[model samples]
Target chain A: MEAIIPVIITSVCVYGLFRRINIFDSFVEGVKEGFGTVRFVAPTMIALLVAVGTLRASGFLDFIAELISPLAESVGFPAELVPMGLLRPVSGSGATALLTGIYRDCGPDSFAGRCASVVAGSTETTFYAVTMYYGAAGIKKIRHTLFSALLADLTAIIVSVITVGLLMS
Target chain B: MSYIFGVMIALGFIYALVSGNMAALSAGIPEAAASAVELLISISGMLCMWSGFMRIAKDCGLTEKLARLLAPLLRRLYPDIDPDSKAFGYISVNISANLLGLGNAATPPGLNAMRELRKRSGTEIASDSMITFVVMNTASIQLVPATVAALRKSYGSTQPFDIIICVWITSAVALAVGLMSSRLISALTRRGRIWKR
Candidate 1:
């Protein structure tokens, strides 16, 4: 994997230069653009982070998790995995924090940790990503996009969790 | 916000530790820290790779070629959009980026696409083309899903590739639903001659 990284980088650089762009300039431009995006997206990202944090700290997350535990268990999902589902769509970092908690509490190889891992693997930060990208772009209408992406996120979580549970177990 | 939660968790652990809840704190902090590190690594890695890839793709003329290749399909999908318009190009790139499972990488392009779309949209609150673009972006099909694979690897999963089937299935379903609903809504408005007037 380490060896492949250089090869991929070199190939990409070579291809870039071949297209009339100076590799150095392209790198600089890319970085500049990235920083610009971070600036544009920072407020929303921070707000989401704080909101998720507040919820978790206030025990709202735990309460919701507990409420959903029974339904989760009926579907073979560990009750602890509920936090992961709730967190997945909101913020990737937030979900990772929750997953880490589960892994620590339940043991990495345990069903709950495994489910969290799978859920992390399958899901996308649908709402957050869309909001940040579209908001920056000044897009006022998303039509069916949010609903569709969310459906994908939900499906990915449920299917991945169940599949991993069955296979890993 | 979630940072507060992390702080709270840390405080709770501290409280637990002082209260002889050593086991809880001992178990929690390390896990939380590990997950935070993993998240940071994944996001940074993805951002780096995608930014680099986009630069390379643009320099290679791949971005334009990609736009050309996608033009026919895009025209069909977004008939209200002018073929020669910037919105068409941006929409094409955005859709392509999503399809490649480079949604994170696609962010820059998606934003650029939306800006171009907005410019072409005039003063309309939400043009038909803009709405379709949004719907497409939201329902963007992902074929690669590198972020998920990275997360799986971080979690010590041996079979990260197993997620491919599930990702494909779910993205496909979502895309179908998104496109159908948007088209239906657009058709209803057209028949009512609401936007036509």
Candidate 2:
């Protein structure tokens, strides 16, 4: 696992050399453009992070989780994992923090721990990805993207619990 | 996007107002701004490295070869982009990096792919292909879920990889749902002729 990236890098350079591609110049050019890409992505990311942070700090996430608890429970989903499921699609770091907390509170071998791991492992930060990709491309009207992404995120969370229950337990 | 962001902030601020958590909310704003910089600082290095290597790969025809190999399948999803084009090549590399659980490494190719798609479409509104691409990414398509496994291992789980099968199941389902919903909504929007953009 550790050797994979280095091997790929070396192979790309070697391949470039064999093809007479001037890998150094190519690399430098890409890096220069990457600097601009970072600059382009920063403002949206900062604004997004603050929005998510505000939501979390205001305890709205907990409120939403509580509101959804009965529905989650009726589906056999553990209430403890609701906050995690809610946060998974919005904030990657927040989901990770919740996942870690689950591991600590329930131990990784427990049902909630297993479910949390599956949830964390299977759900991407839909909001962040949509924002970054669309924002970078200067696309303002995202249309059905957020709708579709949230649907997928919901699927991941629901299926995580089901699959974990079936396989891990 | 504005509506979502605005709703998030507005609802949060309103909740804080009603619940009297304004101090914590105010503190989180700057903290999140700072963390955004921290996140960028961590990702930029890897982003540069991967983008550089990707450029080398592209120059040497590696990405083109990979794109050709993946084209039959990718073509079905992204019919707008020509199989042999740079956009397709970047899309192929992005998906491959994502499958390998190289999330940071995937971003450069993903962004390049988006840019290429945007250029090809020449539209400010996202095309079906771009929507499809972003949905695929947001579905957690990684095969191994390496970070999750590593976290489990660090927490003393003996069989960290045990959840690999479950991850696979959930990812495939999520991706399927995402793609299908996007396609469905796209068809509906087109039929209704509600494409204001």
Candidate 3:
């Protein structure tokens, strides 16, 4: 599946040449704009990353996980995966690191590992996506976006546990 | 928001003080920024490559073709969007990229589409079309879940794509819930009897 990336680029370029498009110049233009986007993204990303790193390094993430695990387990979410579900909405990298940790501590085919993968697949970083899109567009009000996004993440988390339990178990 | 950031940092600092881990607190900021730069480098590489291919797709009429193909679906989802607008075209490409599990590829066009929608609407407040577009982008279904696949493979999963079916099911639910909840909230909060879709 990862190989599809190069296949796509090749297909797009070949199709562009067949259509008599100026692919090189247009590509360069896009490269510059892409660079600009990265620049815009970097500051916001750094701020969020620092916050997340500090929160985890201070044991806040573990504390929250410890507090929430029993409640989550009562509702069918594995206690081991609670940190991931909590951080999934707030920090992509944090959840990713925790995912790798889970994979290391538990076998990948284990319920917890499969459930972690499913959760990662099913959810997007809600506040981060909103901040990037709306911030780039300068849309200030952001009305109803956060609420709906959080709901989506919540549903994804709940469904991940149930889906893995049904299919992987 | 800054509220979340400030609270996290301030709490981290206080927590470190209480727990006597000032060393970790002091090191976190610089370390985070360094890693953020490394992430920026990786993300920029992917974006740089895909953005170019996306431009080629646009220049060669692939985007227009894709947009036309998806027109029926787009129109149903965004009845308020102009049928002939550039916003619709970019929106199609964005959704296509999202479907392929290449959201970095989706970002440039997605932002462009947002700009176009805002321009057409001519208001600081987000229009129904913009809200619909945002929800669709955020909660769009992913067939491949490529990132998760790659991570699982790195961690020695024999069948990393096993979760594809579950990804499909969960993301579909996410899209429906996000879209419906946004529309419901807006409809409820609007002040007049003339609320239009």
Evaluated against the true chain A, what TM-score does chain A of model 2 have? 0.59
Clashing pairs in 3: none
* Candidates by lDDT, descending order: 2, 3, 1
Name the lDDT value of residue A75 in candidate 1: 69
Instruction: Summarize candidate 1's per-residue lDDT along B1-197 as a digit string, tens digits.
Output: 55655664565544554455566445544544444544555455545555655666555666567678988988898887788876666677777766644455567767776677667665525566665666556443655455445545555656544545545555565556656766677677678786567
Each prediction's DockQ?
0.25, 0.46, 0.45
Residue A87: error of model 2 in Å? 1.2
Q: lDDT score, residue A49, model 1?
A: 42
The parts of candidate 3 lying over 4 Å away from their true place are: A1-64, B1-67, B191-197
**Interface RMSD for all numbered candidates:** 6.1, 7.0, 5.3
lDDT of each: 0.60, 0.79, 0.74
TM-score of 2: 0.66
* Candidate 3: Cα lDDT at B139: 69
**Reference-based lDDT, residue B189, model 2:** 77
Query: Judged by DockQ relative to the true structure, which candidate is superior, 1 or 3?
Result: 3
- What's the lDDT for residue B164 in model 1? 54
